[model samples]
Target chain A: MRNSFLTVVIFAVLVSATYFYLKSPEIVQTKLEVLKENYSKPRDKKPVDHSKFEVLQKQFNSPQEVVKTCMSCHNEVHKELLDSPHFRWQRPVYENGRGVTYLGKANAINNFCIGVQGSEVSCNKCHASFGEEEAMLAIDANAENIDCLVCHDNSATYLKGNNMNGFPDKSVDLAVVAKSVGTPTRDNCGVCHFFGGGGNNVKHGDLEKAQFHTTNEIDVHMADNGGNLICIDCHTTENHNIKGRLFTVESSNTNRVSCTDCHTELPHESTVLNEHTVKVACQTCHIPTYAKVNSVNTNWDWSKAGKLDANGKPFETEDSLGDHVYKSIKGTFEYARNKKPDYIWFNGTAEHYLLGDKISEKETLLVLNKMNGNYNDEFSQIIPVNIHYAKQPFDPGTRMLIQPKLAALAKGEGAYWQDFDWLKAAEKGMEASGLPFSGKVDWFNTVSYWPINHMVSPKENSLQCVDCHNSENSRLAGLNDFYMPARDKYELVDTLGNLMILLTIAGLFAHGSLRYYFAKKQK
Target chain B: MKEVLIYKGYERFWHWTQAVLIIFLAVTGFEVHGGYSFFGYENAVVYHRYAAIGLVVLIFFTAFWHFITGEWKQYKPTPQFVKEQIEYYLLGIFKNAPHPTKKTVLSKLNPLQKLAYFGLMVVIIPLLVITGIIYLFYRMPSATNMNPLNLTNLEPIAILHTIGAYLLVMFVIVHLYLITTGHTILSNLKAMITGYEEIEEDDDHHKKEEKKV
Candidate 1:
């Protein structure tokens, strides 16, 4: 009875401890929430005369506010900032705007710079550090505009001065700027462009190391073509406005000059052209468009359209276009919407449509050159002319340049035109004969194009080899005109007949070896 | 004296063949698992796969022979020396002690040995074989279906195979050490070679011998 009581007492203590342990997490969470709610909604209570705290806050605010106050005198710098791509961003909002977010907008920058862009709150902190001294700015007034020396000053060494603080008032703290200015390093850029957050997406491939601020000795992209180009080179301020040029191409809607504008040459060497010549234009292939492709996020509903039922019946039909139609259908009348490539099959129109007038090969080259001038960086296309000419005599207006056979043939080709050379043979043959190759080449003709296939099907170039030759025919054909050439042919017959002699010898040797082994075993 | 060969020539042949093959597999298996590179990784994988297949075939044949010869009775574990044998390995081995039980033609293994061998044959080997075969024919991921072979973490099967190999290696190290602790230092090794062992006659065994005479 005593032992049982002791066990019960121990069990009671364990149960109490366990109950408290499980409840602690919830209790702590509730207390933390309560504190947060109280702090967020500050109420008017008994005012304490906190003079010392106010003095400390004033000192910090005075020096930091210098950048904003100086902006009044240096109005040019402020104007240039308006033209920057950063202007697209609205003031840093907590979670609403499309700017950088601290909670991390899905693919955008992190939460820290949610409101600010170029001259926004966070950027101004580090950027305006060079314009600290009034005497320095008086000597070179333009230095206050960009102040590239703040970060990129390579000859700089550590020194002592005011650490700027505050947003609007102009005052300087005396104690903190006491250290020497360290050598300009990539770490300076890392202050903004680390891990691609905070609205500063400086792409240099190797994100672990900051490549923008410092004179990165090693070219991250092209080791050989490494030039001493700074951010201002690509991002130049025009009209006292920190603005970059934007291309008028229908594709790129944003404001910024493309790197390809100056560096007309591709970073890597082109396979088709030598170093001296320019071959394929970059814009012709990787053509940019202002509108994004495939804008719809979800699948479509087709049940709402009022149309005919399967068997000559009228009903409601909802096509993928999101439009309702009431119709009657007896035959399989196909429909297409949105001009998507796959939807073309149901359009009931011919395969492909042409756009422009047909031009000769020489004219095509001239037109290409005209559309894409030597220095101009843009893409041009003459789709209608080229497409119509390719499918000749098919009522060029009504006939689409749909190469049904060509599309089927091109299916398994590697990314580049794999079987283009083979297809060129047929094109060349027709061109050489100067005759019209009327219809498309069928599957059989495509496969049986080889010379070996021609012998098999003499009528259609399939693979038949024994059509003209046999052993009896060979003998007759060899003796030309039946004249005195029979001795060589008859004597040469032993060459093909030697296999019988060899087999007889092999059989005898096998028989003798077996007999000897069996006889020895018996002994 | 009735002359008794505890192990037959074929039995020893199968024993050594399996041991050598298992050791080869373990070495190559570790190399394939990127533990270290003695042979190149690809070659080691090929060699390990071939050795594993041969070991499986050898095990199949060995099991068949054991059943046919009624030698499967040798692995039947009992309470005989169950505690003493555990004590022998745990503490008595260092003191130059005699074995708790003797090996005879009828019963060559102690209870501990029987249980370990039975566990290895029934549990570990089957697990390794089944997992290995499934891993070898694993399919690529598809749009319609998830990965066909669903191992817990998608860790490469070679890692699991390497774990099995390490377990086998530990077993081998203990086995080799045990083989040396016989009537004489090299007596067990020699017995395996000559199919005979000079077992020391204890008081009970000697009395039984005299009674038989």
Candidate 2:
């Protein structure tokens, strides 16, 4: 009896200790404390608070002055920044016909506003430079041109001037931003990134403003109530070259990040689930829907742009969902929210269609950049992507995709926004890009794929077995190379198997019945 | 009363455990094969794996027992009463003809029982176990790393395991029926359960006092 009492007392103490262990603050509330939209910056770590530095005290004349002062102390870092793609907006790529060709956003044509050749003043707002950074023509960027305050600002209030040649807005306090420089936060990177392709959540469907301060339900890594990871956390950088590459612009697969970087080769505890990781990417299952909070530009038709109202001015109209469906300067658009992605086998390499490349196919939807992989490829896995489709102009005679000059510095400059003429703008843009325009505009359907890489839901919200294992319209319904047990079966084999089982049952019944009848007669 | 020890301790223990495990595996296994959704797919897969491992363990113990005690010879079908045993099951049993082969402690199984058990031991059971193990362990051509066994596709192994399972089910049904064909309908079952059987040696076929060994 005494030993039994001692055992019970020991068990009680163990239970009490475990109960209090979970009740401790660190274990329960760390997830909340570390993740707020605008959490208090750790000023203690700023040993050199630039607020006291005399170099930043006199930055008053212009945005260039702020850059000169920033370079006064950080010239070495600024020099590295100038060589980055973020600064020059171009990179050297090894192409098929041309061994090593220089290409970038400046000359490369997308299904969106075509190219940045003649729209430098407007597009350079997002470019990582101070002023006049156009690489279509030779770029003259140096250490003084590097925009350090844009990426390193922790103040989260720096705004770039719209259509002002990459300068900060006139209202921005250059001294205040210079005094508060630190490592880039989600707010700093997201200021331009979340607004890529002109507006919020329009370029990559998975990236949006909601990610700046969302809960774990939308994005587990970047959510204000989740891991609160910044851009550079996974896209790690060395000497200003980010590790991750986007398939939309990049051609090489050398620089990429994967879930296996931190997780095990087989992350799932169950072997059944781990078996799937070989043929399926983590993002394919983790990111079930893209554009979770805002509507993304799924369709854009440039043919409908320049539609002036009776008052002779371009006007904007909103759809019933309050999303802009018609921007007279950009055209008719179709936006989609919480959209399921198109699944494709991608081995991470992509082949982009460079400008001046002839298109031989007629009356077909052109893929501007096609992801490279097949079911037979050893390195391929099913990945989810958002295909943004568009109807844009191309040269009918030259069979080349046309890039129209979309912005103007002055009136009647042959820019599409000023003259409202496609042929004239195409001529000017082609002249800038050193490509020929056929003097005729014909719009064709084009698409660019953007792989979903963010807004991962919680583990509890992962796909259940039936999501892909069901017979009807499975998420992987398009992938049919191999036999998936629940989702695939040979109809003939199944019928024969069921019939054989049935025949056995029938035979057993008949034999058992006969035995019972004969035995009853004898009895 | 005349009673004899028909089954040893380990034999009875192994047989009942194997029986329970096989039945449970069938229920869960068919569900995993998309036959029905009783336990749900995930639970069915998990439970089927556990029970399959249990069956493999039980088979190991049974093999050791059979080898050590030399009880494996009991499943060898004897040529002496093979014809008479078949005729008895087909025609003699309904007309009250005496059992063609007498039951003894050394030769507990009848000629027909010997033949069926022998077939099951060598063919159907081995087929099921071998194919099931391959199906469980086989990997695709390059799933994780290099496949050591060089077994690529799972289609053939899956179909073969499925056919083996169906045949095992058929054998079980027939075996359950044959157990009732003893002196009384429950006598064979009682012998298996209690490890004792009372056989009347006289031709009268009436109830008699019994002694159990």
Candidate 3:
């Protein structure tokens, strides 16, 4: 019987060993085949030289003149641009399968500079449309108003000043800009996006000027030494319609660009890891921390605006990280760097609080964006986001949030920045937006969430298992809908388990000592 | 005085190997649970998984050996001597009274040991093995295929595995102390090491007489 048992054991061990050993060769062969397929793909050819174009040789006077010349050749481009969210500044919102309202920068109030209703001149600095007057121009009639050089200019000289009617500063050489027109580079996009909310590295935490020529440590995909990819690589655009969505006031029907477009769902080598793709977003793991290069504004208290130094001049203060913590024209700000993101289950859909949305007096309103999803939703994935908090103005009597005409002071209007007068600015803003506002003014807390989608770290720097799994102060600590091992515990089960262990140990000692006493007595 | 060979070489090897694997698994497993961080969380998880695999392999080999050697009968439980064994441990041992049952090469386990070992081997060990395997491959099949188990919810399996771990810990503590209950303090420990045990001549004579009757 013993010999038979030994034989069976040896046979089982040999079979298992043989099976694994045989399986290794096939796995290695498949891996090599996959690697070959990945590397053998054709490389991209160089872009067409704009210098060869005959029409670009002529000298242009104004930025508008440069656009007219480009339109003469690229006729259909203007029509496509006119239909885009960049040109319209507003997109139709559909709720419950019915078009409800057009939400965008034009009318939607944000926690930042409020809205563009009474401040089109200053706010239109980032607007894709040409001229401050173009904001009032009919969307279909402004086909000629699309500023082509804003995105297409390869010349580093093109510069747009605040309230310059979307044209470059007077000193900019339009002739040089027209001649150097090409596909948008990171520099062109970052000119406006990186300096959004009044200064550099202020709005979006992940975007900054440093990203244009950054190392792999800053942004793996956009790194000059690494991927060296341009904005068009991921934000693939066709017919002037950019394939991306910003979590702003705008309601866009356009599809948001996702990492999965290039990297498939099962991008990871481990099958176990690939399974996490179901509930965990690719960005959640890839971009472990946002604002890697610079500190980003996390909070803005508008009530603290209008502070003056001893010289009676508007004072500005810096935070510990050298980011602007207080700008008298703006507010008291809080900045954070290498900021851990707040996680949420997002279903790729967001709802915005429009200009006139009635807010509750008890709870702080999510004024900018709210991710729409729950744990039960199969479409949802755990995504990292940045929540920017603000204390902004609202009409207490009207029971509605008000948009303060923040930039109206630049135009010598009765704006909040001019006289530190909330009522006058709120009235002017409401009038420009065509909404009624009560004379009474009050302050309310608000929050805006921006999804962290950039500054992807290398896989080696990705979050470890215990980072989110084992601690009460974990990233997903507030997410109570699902049970996570180590992070959560059942009280009854833990109590019983500990009790059983204690009892067993006590019983063992008791039995041993009793046996020892009896043996000693017998001896 | 008489000496009897009880444990075979393979049996002793299997027992010691299994003991080492279980101890390693428990220590690393507790660290993985954030009970105490000794190996660090990442290393603890890796070591725990490897030890669990080692234990599973040992269990397979030991089970095969037991069945083929007919040593599986050692754990076959009987209620006949169970009450007396309980009484002997509780009262008779303190009074220096005789044991409830005689130990033979074929029937080496006491009634209490047979019951406890039966439960541990058949229920608790299998429970831990199944749950651990489920957790190790929880994220299998990738995202391409619809996972049949839908292990998106891992709480239930984790709870079961932890419970099994607790039971195993309790059993080890009791087994460790029970080793000191032999004729001399180190008798059982020495017997396990050398595969031979000393039996009283008077007990051996009484067992022969009773067998003849």
Best candidate according to DockQ: 3
lDDT tens per residue, model 3, B1-213: 589887777777777778888998989887776656788776687677667776777788778778887889888776767898888878887887766666667667888888999999889999999999888766422234545565656678888998998889988888888787666669889888888888655566657634532
Model 2 per-residue lDDT at A309: 88
Clashing pairs for predicted structure model 2, backbone only: B1-B209, B1-B210, B1-B211, B2-B210, B2-B211, B3-B211, B3-B212
Please report the candidate that would top lDDT against the real structure: 2
Tell me the spans in candidate 2 whose CA falls farther than 4 Å from its real position. Answer: A1-44, A93-104, A137-140, A266-268, B74-127, B140-152, B181-183, B198-213
Best first by lDDT, ranked = 2, 3, 1
Candidate No. with top TM-score: 3
| Model 1 ranges with Cα > 4 A deviation | A1-523, B1-3, B90-97, B142-160, B200-213
- Tens digit per residue, CA lDDT, model 1, A207-246: 2232333222223121122333334444444543332321
Candidate 2 or 3, higher lDDT? 2
Residue pairs with clashing backbones, model 3 = none
Query: lDDT of all predictions, in order shown?
Result: 0.36, 0.77, 0.76
Assess candidate 2 and give its lDDT: 0.77
* Each model's Cα RMSD: 30.4, 7.0, 4.2
Model 1: DockQ vs. true structure: 0.02
lDDT of 2 by residue, B32-78 (tens): 66646888888787678767776776677668767877888778776
TM-score of chain B of each: 0.82, 0.89, 0.90
Docking class of 3: acceptable
